[model samples]
Target: MEFPCDDNRISIVDLPEDCLLAIFRKLESDTDRNSFGLTCHRWLQIQNFGRQSLQFYCSLTIPNLSPLSQVVPNINSFHLYRLLSRFQQLSSLSLSGCTELPDSGLNPLQYFGSNLQSLYLDCCFGITDNGLSLVATGCPSLTSISLYRCSITDVGLEILVKACKALKDVNLSYCSLISDIGIRALSRECHEIQAVKISFCRNIFGIGFKGCSQALTFLEADSCKLDPEGILGVVSGGGLEYLNVSALSSCIRGDGLAAIGAGFAMRLRILNLRMCRSVSDESVVAIAKGCPALHEWNLALCHEVKLSGWEAVGFNCHNLEILHVNRCRNLCDRGFQALRDGCNRLSVLYMHRCCCVTVTAIELFKYIRGNVKIKEEELMYIGPKWPFFR
Candidate 1:
């Protein structure tokens, strides 16, 4: 059968560009997207220029993508503001781009400043004090802001606390320019600050938490330069539920951890002291006795905790479900009994790379606690994958 030329008839490629984009976004599979792109050069162009299927960003999906930024280095504020005007009630936005979204790029945030509740900008070194000021002034209602590896100093942080008093969560990880002054400023004004992450912020001595101590629930100060008093100050509030002080091996000791166990362990749930070489049996015993409600604990690389600590954990932390003692040089078969006897509800155990714990001991432990799941997962360099994080 011979078909007509059909030159005059409209084809699938002739669908309006916006309609095509909408259809492309609806596609959930990579194969389908690839097939769609192969239809014609026009669709390919659209797919190539835009961010990967924003799927009509329900707000905060890193819209106006990095590819476009790479293509159009200086995407002026006019076009960005105009595009954002569509999402009138938008309350969240994630503008992550490596060097593409400089301080000038954040200028468009002024439009969504009032209703914006959350903002995430990571590795945006271009964002300085001035750009922060712009955001702070516009988004007074902002409750959460994550600025990872930014170049903001205490001056900009002060500017932020002065404006956003209702802030509840802030991540200043790797922001080296900020010091205790910024923390003190936040403590003074940001009374609602509930969660704070100062990871690698070596300048923070931990004195500033006193202001929001009553409201603080989550604090991730891993690898920070906090001494014993600083650790005490952070947990003294007793309202904390999750705390991560990993890699503070040289700065933290048993006394600091014991303080948390003795006084603030009532509400404490998840504690990560991985790589704290100084944490010994006494600290572990104290924590286990006090924080009976502890759900998950990570003691990886803590070589100092001995059989006593494991025994104490089993005796007290009946609710302990997940335990990680990976690479514990001294963890042996005898210690496994303490856990097997006490933690009846223990569901998961991670003993990867533990040289002292024999295979027969593991088999015996498994035979007894058949309901518990055991896995030997070596530590990977992956970023922290916890609930409070991010």
Candidate 2:
């Protein structure tokens, strides 16, 4: 049987090498590119050279990663650290959920030490302080490190800060073992540290930001054991732009909020006080009075915040765009009206589970110039299910 072929047809191979590469670059998706590359040897070579980031999901066997590394030699962003020597230009690596990646597997990363900058080992349960110590020693150029739910402790953190002086952003969220010692070490050593997230670290207390980097702009210590002193230490740092002190119900009070508002008046933009039950109108008033640059405020589950506080925020924070007052049971129609009257720039308002808030109250937000979007939950029924039966 004769195969159908047009005599005048110009095949893709007939095109110039550069033109072929340009065509491959426009493929958009990696899968499509890979498929196109597999069509011919030249396309494959072009794809390999042009490839910048590569992700291998559960495909890499811990014992032997040579085959995969040999497959993608020019990858800069990698998931597996097994044969990093092959990829000298590697800059970002994420070993998230790589349960098989043990301490010994991290040895390969030493080859790309100087080149690697962003490292994420989130939820890598096997990675302990020892493994991280190796990481610190190897990846000295690391600027961003996220170890969410990792087994790393203050010891590992100390080692990391001691070695990685260029470190700017670090996330130790859910690192339960981390405490004041580790945080203090970071503050003392890493002067370039801009953002530190220690949320859900229950053991952390008294993380004094007094001596820390003045470059520190973002701090997230939600659900931590930070007291008033700790809170003051953070706000007093004078460079904070984004602060999330949510769920510090026991330690944070009106005074602490006021201090934050006053200290970070011009810089403060995003403030999250979720589940901070102790915070009342007094604290909100203080924030409104001080933080003129406030844009996003999350007072979710803060039961104490009433109409007065909402009004204060709306009236004071002119730049406020997103406001989350979810579960603020005290918020009513008057509060919504106040918010509408004060916050002209308000665009997104979340009032989920706000039992006292009526539809009539929410209607007032309709007149907002930019068209305000209000997210609310079903009206909560506080009375007995069967009044007659009761």
Candidate 3:
């Protein structure tokens, strides 16, 4: 922005930093602040940093204007667009709890949706397949979207991917209606998607991710009722850096789980299998061989894994930094010794109610490696007594 006079001229860009900051302080509204930032990249950077000292938004105060959620039902598309058009630089929109906002409420997005890159509709129960279609049609530039607990099925998912090819991160957790069919659509169509969180979506298995093999890195799909084949499908991509398939119980077969360490282990850094009761030493040893680069491992409540497994972890996974083996019933002092001896880089160790591990072993490890942070509790109170091989 430039101010011109007959003899002299000055630009907003030429103003001193202090003058710019002083001028920005007088503007209170988010829209005004947003407009101030859009003058140039320098002003945008300054506005973002300066907001910490002089801020805007309703917060706990009275709504300066009608809250967007309250006006959803009554506001017409034209009025809504006219109101939202004030903030020409709006990039992130969160309507996480507008439970009653029907599909028509999304019509306003079409008018000013190009500026939006992230949309969060978590727990919006009224957003059916039709509503998501509106979102896909309106917000073509959306790179990240969360549909947590939304009532959308495969049709809605198919519609979304067909329109928004730039989607990189999506959250479908607890979206009970979605299944592998919907996921396959996402996998095949959205080539740029890197993170997919599908926790508690029981119908989906790892097989749907077969198409996201090239770019897939982070996957968190805990308690999805995965079977043997499903477990195998999870590691099939092998490019994953962080993987969590925790709480997978009775349905998964031993051989299927063991194969994760044997064949599919790529450059995995973090692996979480907490409460997976069927994880045996075979799987553990195979994991040690397959994923020697593991940095953080959580085997909490894994009663089936014994000393051999611990020994393998110590000998092979030298890069191991943090470990959680709380309630591992059979892991004794020798098992602890293997970890103490081999995992020199071990920094954080969590062991509570590991009854078979005597206090002497813990004390000795502390004496040897004083830097290793340990989290433990007295086991005598609740640990199994001589009645069951204490």
Candidate 4:
């Protein structure tokens, strides 16, 4: 028995060193570095230089660890902490899905303190205020932090706000533990803070975001327990560029939206109220009158709004690019006519399950040579069937 081998072979030495490095950088995320390290001795040498900044969303599981153990030492908390002490140039970190890490104290801080600028602990249930305090105190360069769905209290938040005064963006979405007191603390202390996301914080009962020290650019809280006063607090803040309050769909009818429109008339850009079922043309007109600078708006499934509201949006929001009005049963051909005529700049429009639109409306699309000459390059309609009925 004999084995045949190809005589032709490419020389790794001939390739430019920089070219080899580019390949190594791209392979950094391939766990255990097997893809690049096993390629050749030259490839293994390229890995030693280390890339600029390595970021990982999931765990950086060690290869030698068993399937049951993502880290060394058989899933021990202390051992896992030791494993993370190796990353040197990690500036940004994302741990969106890790729920096993211990959150009682700052056990993870020692590994993260060196050069971290941004940290995302979204949905990491293992962490508590103590861990957060460690982050605020240890990571001096920290500018942005997200604690989405993390269990946190006013104490933890107060410490973070007080310690990380340089912080700019903080996302506390779905942290039900927070209330008006925590928000007031954030507003009073975090002066340099620019953008704060506080969606689904149901405990924020009556207090408004009136005393916030910094100007807010984005605010979102859908399907959380909040009254008219809470809604008014955010609208009165006035520096909002993006706003979403679908949770208060009924409370923020025409009047609330009108107030938001009037307050954020200059800076408002994106608005999303997918299930704001009670919002009618009254609020739509108010928004059209007030928020002229809107670029993208989503009123998907808003039942009460009539066709006239679409006309107001078409006529006023010239810079509008994306619109999602799916399931607006009351919408008619006249409203679409306004949308086609006034919303000439639209690039993406979603009109799924809209029963009022006729087959004639489908022809109106630029592709069908209707009056509205929207470029074929744009436009996206959902639902099946020709002419898109209902």
Of models 2 and 4, which has the larger lDDT?
Answer: 2
Per-model TM values vs. the true structure: 0.78, 0.77, 0.79, 0.72
Going through the candidates in order, what is the number of backbone clashes in each?
A: 0, 0, 0, 0
Q: Which runs of model 3 end up more than 4 angstroms from their true locations?
A: 1-80, 377-390
Model 2 deviation from native, Cα RMSD in Å = 10.1
TM-score, predicted candidate 1 vs. hidden true structure? 0.78
Enumerate residue pairs that collide in model 4. none
2 against 3, candidate with superior lDDT: 3
Ranking by TM-score: 3, 1, 2, 4
- Tens-place lDDT digits, model 1, residues 1-390: 977678877877788888887887788898887677676788876565333211222222445666444332343466557655544445666664444556776676776567788877766668899889989878889888888888999999999989999988899999999888899898788877888889999988776665355788888888887876676777777788888888874667665677668766578878888888888899898889888778888888989988998899889998888888899887888888888888977898877888998889888888999998887884532223544334
Error of 1 at 54 (Å): 8.8
Candidate 4 whole-model C-alpha lDDT, 0 to 1: 0.67
Lowest-lDDT window of 10 residues in candidate 1?
Answer: 51-60
Task: Give the worst 10-residue stretch by lDDT in candidate 4.
Answer: 381-390
Query: RMSD (Cα, Å) of candidate 3?
Result: 8.9
Distance (Å) between predicted and true CA of 8, model 2? Answer: 26
Clashing pairs in 3: none
Q: What local lDDT score does residue 177 receive in model 3, on the 0 to 100 scale? A: 89
Which candidate model has the greater lDDT, 1 or 4?
Answer: 1
Candidate 4 residue runs with Cα over 4 Å from true position: 1-77, 108-114, 205-208, 211-215, 235-237, 247-250, 365-390
| lDDT, residue 207, model 3 | 70
lDDT of 3: 0.76
